[model samples]
Target chain A: MIRGLRKWAVPFAALLVLAGCGYDDTTVPKPEAVVTTPAVPTTPVKCDNKLQSYAPSDNRGAAIANLANKGRLVVGVSGDTLRLGSRNPETGKIEGFDIAFAQRVADELGVPMVVRVISAADRIGLLEKGEIDMVARNMTVNCDRWSKVAFSAVYYNATQKVLVRADAEKDYKGPQSLSGKRVCAPTSSTSVDNIKAIQPDVVAVLALKHTGCLVKFQNGDVDAITGDDTVLAGLAAQDPYAVVPKQGKLTDEPYGIAVNKGDVALARFINSVLDEMRSDGSWKDTYDEWLKPYLLVDATPPTPVYGR
Target chain B: MSQTATPQAAPPPAAAATAPAPAPAVAAKPTPGLVDTPALLNRWQLIGMTTAILFGVFSALIQFGGWQADGRAADDTEQLVRVQEIQSSLLRADALATNAFLVGGLEEPEQRKEYDDALESVLRQIANAAEAQPADREVLATLNVDVTAYATAVAQARDNNRQGFPIGAEYLSGASTELRADALPILDALVKANTDRAENAMAGQHPFWLLVLGIVALVALVWLNRELAQHFKRRINKGLAIAAAIVLVVTVVTAFAALLRDNSNDSLREGELATAVSEANARTAANDAKANESLRLINRGSGEGFEDLWSVSAKEVEKFASRDTRSGWDAYVAQHNEIVELDRAGKWDEAVEIATKEAGGSTESLDAFDQLSQQIVTANGTQATDDLRSGRVVALVLSGLTLLLGVAAAVAVSRGIGERRREFA
Candidate 1:
């Protein structure tokens, strides 16, 4: 029996010795592709704009005309916004309220709409960098954006306002009540700058995305999300959150397509399209199609004021 | 056994041949007789010698058995210790996953902050421990991926909460749910794998004492038997008796070593394994319960979403029940069922209240889980500690003892063989 056991032991030992640790080599999934569309040229390409001379202070006006003739419309846009220049999870497409407007101008220009996605702070610099021809990313016309870039017709009228949790709606009225509370808005937009200018004591957190600003409100990270009514309305669609500073517009957030200072003709072309869009009901159609989903059905059309 | 051992029986033929002449050789020369007893003996002599040989064979067998047991026990203990630390972290992870689900679901200020703090801590602990551990790359990688998901969930949760969007809860709940579901099963698998090690540790303690005792017993018996022959004034056959005695003792110790090892394994299987599996199951259930509550909120009785979140969280709770469980989570299940029914009926307020009660009760906390989870955690912890108990001093001392005992057995066997060799010459 001992001899028999000894014979078996060696094989058992060998088998145990050969026993190896388990292993599995799983293939790692590659990172998802981000479709990087080419940036539009910001140099003044509006050859038609060269026919007319504009004031030297029109830094943005001169640049748009130089950039537009290159057959590319460098329209400054936002990439972080959903339903407007935001990523579409299904088709991997970027679409929204503002993009269509930019597309229409580019389409009318007979140029490729190379949308230069940007934060508001860089809108002016991008035009200066000759990296974009126009800014249509819901930019508010104030002394600030106007000082850097010449404006065109205001297509959309925006207002600075407050968004709060539905529960808090009963108490909060305006800037004074919002004191000691945090407010958020995308940096370089009129809402944040205006909040600073108006409710200077209000703590403001500047986020890159308006959605982010709105989320801060939801997380109770802030008391209010302060931005253009258009942006805030977009935020409200995703959540049941309410907008405050209840009635009437704050500082008039006049939506304009920013152009280089000297580019009168491209501005004229843009102006004519706005005119055509307004007269031909394209402007109303765009609003009815895009912004209508998030706004009141009785949303009144803002009168388009022409640039000098 | 026959299939493999048939060829091995070849050596016994030679032993039979050598067996005949030992008695004659013992008579011819006293000096040669000492070394040459068994080799010079025939079949009858060998057969007669076998009875006396039992002690020696048993002693050697006992010594070997003890040595094997000692080695296995040492390895088992070391592994269990390591497993325990990992298991504890995993346990905590399961709890935090539930917390994340709960907080993300509520998107309430207190809950969100709590979830964030707990999850961040879990991630940090996992990272810190991972650096110190010698875990498989795949396991480590998976853990890292889980951490990233956790981080993303936290970020997104924060974002959505700020916006007052319920989707933040949905995202966080999703992260916690998927992770808990996938993660616990893997951890349970890890715990199950070390069962053999736990048994080996328990069995290891006995072999050294058994070996030493066998050596002592065999020596005493051989000395007593040899002197008995010498007292009679005859060259008595005592070596075979000693050898035979050794064989029996060795066989007993070997069998005992194996038995004790099996006993330890049984202990681990019954104790730690059961605990790990049960606790993991409970944790997953808790997570599912929380997730279901969150989904109920996210769905908000909207469109097809009500059906979707319902299916997801329902499956999770059920999966926990199917796995091994320690405590009867019947209380939790009862609450969950009511919540689900209320949810199905679109009674949001009632479901929310029950959810709050179920989630908030300190007694039903995931840390304890009604004693079952605690017991399971303890069992797994105990099993896991075998390989992982820390302190270099204890390890050094244990290792030294094992080595000394092994060396002592080997030397004693070698000496016995040398003494028999002289008679064979």
Candidate 2:
């Protein structure tokens, strides 16, 4: 019996050992690389009077008829530009300096206000497509944009400025102070280009929006953020460590309300609304309510230019 | 009973004298009238005993392999389910966080607690899965890093949101994007690995091999019996016959058991295990869709991109949802459609109200579906694993018995050949 068992013992023991074999180490597959197409460049358009708009008129009926969605003034604005146009966490409503102007236009037109949150890059496209009645999202009036869409006269005289750490605020004097430092701005906004053009040595980083830049700043991914004084003021208000030191402006960013190129009547109507805001002291009240605390300065609305 | 030895036939005197003297170095040649019957009998005994013993070891070893395979299949199934649960819980946490963001600063405390609990469950499961499956440890470590990054970003978002900063929304959106990009793919790999392990393990039962082994052993036994019978007057040797019968019986019984086990495993792989995996997929997709819904709302008017993602996730849920959980999913889909209609009509506030409300809302409806799907996954997964593990002890005992029975058969062969030798002497 022992000999019989011994004959197969080696193979049996080998089988048992094989049973204890382990599997190979598992692996995670790497994600496929994203392919991005290079952007096509277009020639910059130059016009004599980019700030000029249609003369103001009180024609609510025609303006309402020209709306993309009748009975609702679908105006695109930023929901992240704090004092200019941002959503209130407490009330869950968009209320700020820019939103005040949007609400006033809708009220005068006797229509409901529908606030569409949009990025700076989308403002021109949305207006030209007639997807929105107007854009009040701190859009800067320039010659290139004037060919694509009509603009209400400059409503606020904003100047490009840089916001840096509070500790570094004293050393900042001009765009040259940002040379070789990483400066972030909204991707399609003119602020990054303006700073880069002036210093040439500054590393320009772009994000989806100004608030996205602020996120990068808080995370120490960028050395400074650059945008309009009004936008920088809002960003500064959010972070105590950030400060916009007194410095020469990189460029004059004249804010405007944009409409479709063919919507002259709506553009005139928006100018009329702006005229009312200026005369009734409502614009001042709005500026005081939303911008004064952060800007630390008293301000008056810009004189509206007309006769385009 | 002791039997008297039979009288041997004496060799002829002339034949013994004529046989050459035995060589010192080589085996002596057989005389013309004499045969070496004892040597021949020893060779037959060795062949018969070796065949019987080898048959016993190989068959038992095969059965033992099947038993171990079933155990591994059960463990792999459990790990598969556990990894899937971790995926579902991670998405569940994201859904809760995004939905709470829709409510603004003061999120519902219960919802907050649920989010916390879901994240805690994910972390705990990741640790357990690492411990359960060593092959998965590396990926789980990377997943832990991604989850930690997401959690940190969410905390930052909450802090900014409390201060009413719009950057909070950016932080939340960024965290959501990172979670999908970094953490989800690792989980996908883990799920696929465990799934393959479980399915392959289920195929381990080999009834055909067992049957073939039995047939080969029986042929050897028959050949030995034939050789013994040709030399002896008896047509059949009693001990050899008993040994052959034992081999035949063990072969049939073990092969039948193996066949039954193979069929049972096939049924489990198709039925209960399939259901568990499907329901888990549905639950994960459901949570992903819900998170997209909240993201659409959070993005407000520019949420067309998020809406497109929601459509894709909804289709996944529809495809994988089980029959018992379909009603809940259908109800949630109806509510989601309503939210979409309201949002498209530019009634964003009303849409948000419907989405964030505690009752009669999309959140409540989706919660119902999520709960039902989770229950189905747990119950069916447990049942599948339990079925795989149930007959382990019996298989082990049978293996041991087979080895002992082979020894007994070998002894029978030895005794039968010894009896023949005694008769020859």
Candidate 3:
């Protein structure tokens, strides 16, 4: 009987011993899988389209192609720039002259769009990275931008103008005549630098963004706000400020699309789209759709000069 | 104190012989010395039951082993799949918004196809993953809600833009925030569940061996009882006989441990995969939203506020996404320069041309993103399912098998006792 008991124990003991021995002492080996490469690395090209002399330099096309493949475009704009690109709080879309212009380019690509809301100071860096595809937020064309991004054909005419406190227009002349006066400008903008060039000794306080400048100027922050005439006019239209500039113009501010430094393909595509829009009534329609509602504060925008 | 000591006083002698101590002693229990009860099992009755006990231990050990081998892997993979599903949907939503924005703020026929492709793929993936794990209904439902909200945001943003309002940025921003808040929580939960499962599976690998040893010891007891009954032609070896029943119990315990280990491992794998997928998805969505913000701000008017969002978003994606868009960024800069040149030359029309080009490129980028996202999501999802299935199978099959084996062993031993008793009579 004892012997039988010993034999009966054999089966379970054997199985247990077997299972124990079979149990892997080592950790499970993971299979070596192929590693995937990260997304390709490339530098974004930025350019000032307004610098083009009819022919878009090579950079324009490159910028456009870059935008095309991403399946979406990033543009720097404002939602409160009323009549130019401001959004209606109720509806929630950017409606303005600048927005209209943005739509025209987007329309040509048959793709999606992303608009980064920005103030003036953000345009340069945003354009430099692939952050915003282009700065259509009423950016001014200037030499500094030339080093950053390629420009397209001029689209809108803007000129250096002065915006004074609602009651300061009586004594103000122009840039040179504003010596010893405290003026505010949006930081890192051609307007500030340009103002410095003209009124070298004027007191200049640079606001990081247009909104900041507007807020400060409204609160008696500075004696004047100087920038492109159209922008100054638009801002003045919103408040009781008076825009004071030379009867003609100080500096030309033609708004253009900003692309990367070597995107010529994008430049041509933009040019073609522009040509189509200009003749097809889309340009006029966009301008009217965005600008007409807010023109009551000022005379309706002068006809946009389309260079032949 | 005297009352509590009564129980201990009674067991003082026998307790030293029978191995199992009270549950309260668990914390203070010496580990290596007590992992198995072979020492106390040296008694005649215990020795007689050793075979059955060893079997119990073996079954337990194997059950735990399978949990580690198959359970954890499955859990991690499944979790990753869940994350992928959530992430993919976010990416899809972003693509839709960008497309809508580009299409003149309306459903452009040309852009619709691309939108449809991206949207359908992501939605389908979410649905499929949800189906795979019906246990995670909360997460799936939340994701669905987020997708719907995102779609609405895109539509509204478009409508507003067409109507000439700049609420596009607001709508897109809201959508992005909503995704982060609503959908991500579920993903986190799912990931945790899987992670726990995997850890449990890992733990089972070792314990199952000891449990099998217990089972084998029980089988040994049963064999000895039958042998003894036959040898003396008597009813039973009472001590050895009853101990055989204990072997069955020990086997049941081993089975439970194995089952639990497998379940835990499965959950763990699923949790890990879900996290990874969720991360990727969130990144994609945020990037899409940021891009939309960029467009809206630029279209509204150049300003620093938009730039801030853009930079933050770009920096965020720089770590997760490939840096392939630099050329694209470069191109946009070039176009911006062209526009500037035209503006400088007083050629607004030509400058407008440049804007069109940059917009086109961005649109294209959004379109292609959907394709890549879909591919990767599908791959990750497949891996997760495979692991989940493996753990589930082991948890279910081994649990049932070990339990049945324990019951059968008990019945066989009990019947042998009856036969032996009759033979003695």
Candidate 4:
């Protein structure tokens, strides 16, 4: 019995030695595998469309008084965004649909609109910091943003879509065609996220600006440029090689002027101004002048959807 | 009881004659066999000899450290700037290539021109980087090969695309993969190596030898002064004391300058270097995300793969982003989800519209990143410049001090010997 036990013990010891050698080098920690979870809410964003127009008053709110005292409507506009809010390189004048809207606000306030060239990232922060009194640089009104800042109204309703090369045999008609294709979008916009949600297999590239995506699309670095129809139209216009498919719209983006969270009186006043603009056909005239060429069709201004 | 003036009163000749008598004696105590001679090292002569040796060694040490530090300042900054240039050019080239391809087979004239210009810029940047870092020639050579391959692939892909071939997309995908996997890793390695080199240079302080020399010189001076005082029945040798004081002062000054250089290097590594690295990574992520977008169109319906890629890169960019850019990143993420939902629900056109829309979506996020990254890059550059300048200045000062100390040590000892020699003569 002792001899048999000894034979088994020797074999067991050998096995242990073999295991120790393997174990010694394999103890390093492995990096955790990243799992992508869909962050889109199953329930659509809840929006409030309540709008009680403010009565015109001589006693301006603190925000309005501050702007009046400053003698200018400090409005933040995108300098690089083309056909929307951009500075003319030769003229050095800020011109776009957003700029026009901002100017209207200045006109009502009896002050000049001092256009401060700002990027999309600065829209909310600049308002909160009081660096700019209002942000009209193609800002979209959403539930997430409403919590942080006040929106005037949905001044413009834009649709999301794809811009692709026109001469291609197989048209990227919809998200299904975009599955394996590379799509370029600005990091500051919802385009990339939308592409990700629609077809998780689609390669989404985020650029610093829409122009960055446009450039990438034109260079064959990306298969298509995915964004709002308005912006896609502008990009398509720039490059005769690209076109927006007449297939369908991706999502509805309601553009609004953003004010600081605490500026309720100013927001109401701005909403009233928007209401007047919508009724008087002033908004349509502005849209036609700045956005009509890219839009290719005369679309009426979106009715105000105020979240108050 | 002053000794009679004698020409043979020099220390060296006396030491040579009685050298055998004290050959085995390591003790400092003097005996009768010892006599003063300029030819031999008596205690005072010994002081002068040790001082000269110590000062010479210390001077070499200080000079070597200064030269090394100065070289590091130039090399590190140049490498860093080169890395930045290369990174920018590579990213731009990739963007241009993709945009050109997106224009279909014919490729738009303006877009083609832009692509050509971007490629040319990348070549120039690589050449510039190579000129500065000869040791990186091997890595640059690999990059050069890879870039050529990428360009060739793109051109072929273009031809196929113009003919309306589906295979064109495949070629384009292959090229993009090569650039991301093969090219980027090499560039990253180059950056890491240069950073390490800079850190090593900054931390390179070898004052131990100088300290030992200073201590030894001081000991020799004190012992010699004591021995001389006993021989001449005087309490001090003013010249030797002055020499010792100069050595002490210069050593302290040299040490302080080295300290300054070290501190400046630390500041640069912790502040500017850190910021630069973070921004570079963010930029890379942003560019990668753009590249993945194109891949989504190639694969068509399986865009979730690209989405995963974008998600990782976006998170990385967000991680390094400053406060100003954080809000933009958050918004971009929110928009991304809506775009995805639209696509998944068969509203591909709608998803595209939202994605391409103005004032929101990826544009907002990208703008935010750009602003913050630009700010970070500027700040990093300023800080790096300040730190490099500080290091160079400290090196110059230390080098100058070493030279001054060497001269002072020589002058003080010579003057002391001259005074005694005059008395003896």
* Per-candidate RMSD, Å: 18.0, 3.5, 16.2, 19.9
Q: Write the per-residue lDDT of candidate 1 for residues B1-425, one digit (tens) a residue.
A: 12122211112233345565566544444442233333332222323233223333333333344344444444444444344334444434434434434333333465545445555655664455344334434554576676576567657755655554434544554555556555544444444444454454445334454455556555544554464355334454444354434444554645464455555555655655545544554454455444444444433332134345445644543554323342345455555567667644535445546555444532244334424544555556555455223232433343334333333433333334334433433
- DockQ values of all predictions: 0.02, 0.56, 0.09, 0.01
Poorest lDDT segment (10 consecutive residues) of candidate 3 chain A: A22-31
| Fraction of native Cα contacts reproduced by each candidate | 0.01, 0.77, 0.18, 0.00
Q: Candidate 3's residue-wise lDDT over A1-308, tens digit each? A: 33533544667457546543321111222335789897574454454443552352334335456773376666677655656666554433455788777777876666555565666666677666756666677776555566677666767766777777646566566677668877787766767667778879889987755544665575576778877665665666655555553444668877777676665566566666666667787776776655544432222222332231
Q: Report the C-alpha displacement of residue A184, candidate 3, in angstroms.
A: 26
TM-scores, chain A, per candidate: 0.73, 0.95, 0.71, 0.78
| B26 Cα displacement, candidate 4 (Å) | 24
Best by DockQ: 2
Number of the candidate with higher lDDT, 1 or 2: 2
lDDT of 1 at B132: 38
- After superposition, which runs of candidate 1 have C-alpha atoms over 4 Å from their true positions? A1-308, B1-135, B163-170, B177-236, B302-328, B357-372, B383-425
Task: Name the best candidate (by TM-score).
Answer: 2
Arranged by DockQ, best first: 2, 3, 1, 4
Clashes of each: 105, 0, 243, 117
Candidate 3, true inter-chain contacts retained: 0.18
Ten residues in sequence with the least summed lDDT for candidate 1 chain B: B1-10
TM-score of each: 0.42, 0.94, 0.42, 0.51
**Model number with the top lDDT:** 2
Which stretch of 10 consecutive residues in model 2 chain B shows the poorest summed lDDT?
Answer: B1-10
lDDT of each: 0.52, 0.88, 0.54, 0.64
Q: Which runs in model 4 stand beyond 4 Å of their true positions? A: A1-308, B1-47, B95-118, B205-213, B354-364, B371-375, B390-394, B417-425
Per-residue CA lDDT of candidate 2, range A175-201, in tens? 888888999999888887788888999
